[model samples]
Target: MTLLEWPASPGFPEPLWYWVEDWHRLLLWATDQAVSDVTLQANQPVVVERHGRLFPVTRRRLAPAEVYHLTQVIYGDNAPSQLAGGQDIDCSYEIPRGRADLARYRVNMTAVRAGRERGVEITVRTIATTPPPLATLDLPPALRAGLVFEQGLVLITGPTGSGKTTLLAAIIRHLLEDPHAHRKILTYEAPIEYVYDFVPRVHASIAQHEIGVHLPSFAAGVRNSLRRKPMVILVGEARDAETITAVVDAAMTGHLVYTTSHTNSVPETLRRLVSAFPADGRDGRLADLLEALQTIVTQRLVRTTDGRRAAVREYLRFTPDLKDAILAQPPARVVAATRHLVREHGRPLTADLDALREAGRIDEREYRLFRGLGTQADAISLPLPAGPDAPEPGEADGPG
Candidate 1:
């Protein structure tokens, strides 16, 4: 069914078409339908993903020229020319909802092989207008306690689409909503996802900076936040060596820091961060990182039996004893030592998955898939039946 066949809602107009002229309306309709992502590819019908499945929204395929024009409209006039330079573009887009309201999206334009010619595909992930409350997240007691630190580093590690941003946002929202806690928070995100203007803050305040728009990179943003006198700093992701060093420095100088990394488990997260430094000074950097570390929580989203998804997490709060235990191990045994210590004093991801399966929150296939993986809990979600215009079998990519 097309957009017109869908019932009219409060702010949505009724006579919307499936063509590019009404692209914003189509996105709004997809949002209303609880779509998580929207894809626009050359010579393909507009597609939307919901509940880990993809389906087409438009009946007719979009021409190459139409997609090119659409790309220009979403980005700037130089978008197509920029894509021709063998580089993908990532930026944010929004539809004006009211005088001061907006529905923002994280958009990416990638160059793909369309027959012998180069084609463009635009993928858009919807951002929630406001972050959910931390109480709704049902985090473990240990994790909740670790968030009360005054000066240390807290990392939420996971792959893309694993709710890392959502988890950080909830924690930030909780800190801001606390009446007794008075502080300043600075955040640096690649493209700001969740806007917090509607959140009612008691005494805490926040300022956000985009990576490219406000600052050149994550490292620069971390360095910039130090001069702003914020009690807490949030770095979007600690990917490179420079950014990791900056995060460690901020934590060292008596400022609470929070960041995300694209790692699967707690031990791997530590290993990855320590390995980012040069080999000559790697041991020193590892000591600094372990000393300033407060907690590392790795999260993954698994498909549930009810067509939704649930977050399974592994977390560790690094006490002095645990830190010493890790440091005492040689380089070859560091990962093994960390794993043993985590199981002894922290929550392993396998236990959480087992609990979910026992409670019937997740099915047996999903549990076995996650349980069989190694330290890196990278497992593909079980494929579901697609919609009317869904892609052919084996064409669907799993969750990002």
Candidate 2:
């Protein structure tokens, strides 16, 4: 099939192109706009997300035929067959910019019913070709140090678009750069994001696999990694009971396993993982999980005062005492115990927000928003500054 070429000057004032037929040019334009995501749907204007805000890239709405053609370009000839199976598909899309540069996106294609007609909605998330350095991620020194474990499970948890994958990539980069340890790192992802071949890896070698493309599932990938004799295993997500069990088993057998979860806090992450198992085996599974856990890092991104986003993290490193306490108590008490530890040892999310506020790194309104501190004075341990000039803690927009 021949791909359509976009006009040199395309936008308002020009004829409306109901079909954005040039995928490469559209993607290139999105890349130049620093778009984090692009959404294309039949009968809807093409939209792009930048800095957590969505805006239309073009005023013209796309047609169903255009969406189908784009999907074919993205997924090749097999797209029609795959879509006929009545399930969403995830894949990676790339546009070559120059001899050395490429723009990559993680694409999700789903079927949508427009009355009696079946249409498609495509959402593409931009990914950096190279992972950022660990130091640049603003992680605490102690937490960074604790991530370099030989045998244990380290989980990075956060909501979607919270930069969990970016943080994990940085951690993997750190491990690859270590001079003393010659390690074999194996990673399993739905669609592989970062490419480490360009980096100078003298001591470590990395092998990345895609979940549906290279392996059947995350659980199968984890089980397969064991036979490959890898020192570090990276599971994109411990999303289901089977995958979680596989990760635990891999850690138990003396491999360092890293994974992500869609949870907001340490205790909540633990609870979610334990809830994956049946009630009869939850306690025992929770105990085993606690024993294998090395760290739980929960991250959030807030708008900085300078008009950029900065990471605010709440992490808990498992010490022997804390692990023992977690094992002894029921899962119901874990949240309270975790809160006590956050007050005493770990840095709580509220404290991080407060510090940012005190340093003037973020505005008072944003501070209160991210901290979830309401008007009730006693609701929060650290009270907002009290004065006539100060804005009321409750007088702010919704949380970011």
Candidate 3:
């Protein structure tokens, strides 16, 4: 059908049973509506989240069999078997948008307890086809400077859905465009959210490998990248000790490495990575991590007065002096020491949020929400003075 002549699909039709093409059309419609997430469940109407609100887009609740068929259509025939084995499947799905572009989604399918019986629920997060330029992100000078290091570990960290992947993608796109950077970049992602096909590789070349589809794991991907002579490696997540160890090894061996983690701030990022190793070897691992550390950026997306979201970032660049200070501390004292260095040489998230509040970019309620999102331990761990709106210990706060 011609673009203009195509049927207008705001929601699903009356039919409870949908074809694979029907689901694709519905997703395209949701994308056009600026929906950020789509949810499908066994006994619920198809729902979409747009502008931070959720609403049903289908007239009828989907049957269990229909949901099963839809999973097969998006994921594959093995999705049912995989979900049956008690493993939630995380993968990427794509549909052609036109002759050259594709629309992509990060998909997760799991078996949910539906009124005492098992049923399926699928969550799909929409991703941009093209990565934005790094300049457009308006990262602070300190954070931007850390991105150019020849060889070290640069971590982009935050809670889930806090724009960590988007930020990392922009950094990779920046590297790919630099005329002086003529480096070979390799990326290991679970589902490969962003594709660099449209970005002109002016000097650097990149190859992206999906964890389950190509390599078996992130650790394996890092090890494999070494054999292929990559100058830069981007790892999707460094959650396990093996992957974290591999990341540190790659950095110490002179390959620039970029990775992400689920963390709240700079001090927490260091603690999480260092604590990943066994206690007997943690001191050595912490020393290696410190030696190879370049930067740690923790980001949070908060609502602005304009009704859109803005990123408030806290970051630390580990200069030689800062690294030495951290290394001098005992293992039990490293986190506290890092917090001290962050205040001395880096920008803290509270400071950024306060500036945004003063400039009227965000409302006071939004400010308080993000300001108090850190854990009680995080609040106690860092030695920085508390913001005016800092929450009490163990007090609940909104998502970061």
List, residue by residue over 14-122, the lDDT tens digit for candidate 3: 5657788778887887777667799999888888876555677777888878888888988889988889899999999999977999989999999987666568999
Model 1's alpha-carbon lDDT is 0.81
Give Cα-based local distance difference scores for all models. 0.81, 0.78, 0.83
Give me the candidate number with maximum lDDT: 3
Give the root-mean-square deviation of each candidate in angstroms.
9.4, 8.0, 5.9
Off by over 4 Å in 2: 1-21, 373-400
User: What is model 3's C-alpha RMSD?
Assistant: 5.9
- What is the per-residue lDDT of model 2 for residues 3-62, given as tens digits with 9 covering 90 to 100? 112222324342344334467667776776667788988877788776666677666787
lDDT-based ranking, best first? 3, 1, 2
Candidate 3 lDDT at 271 equals 75
Model 1 CA deviation exceeding 4 Å by range:
1-21, 374-400
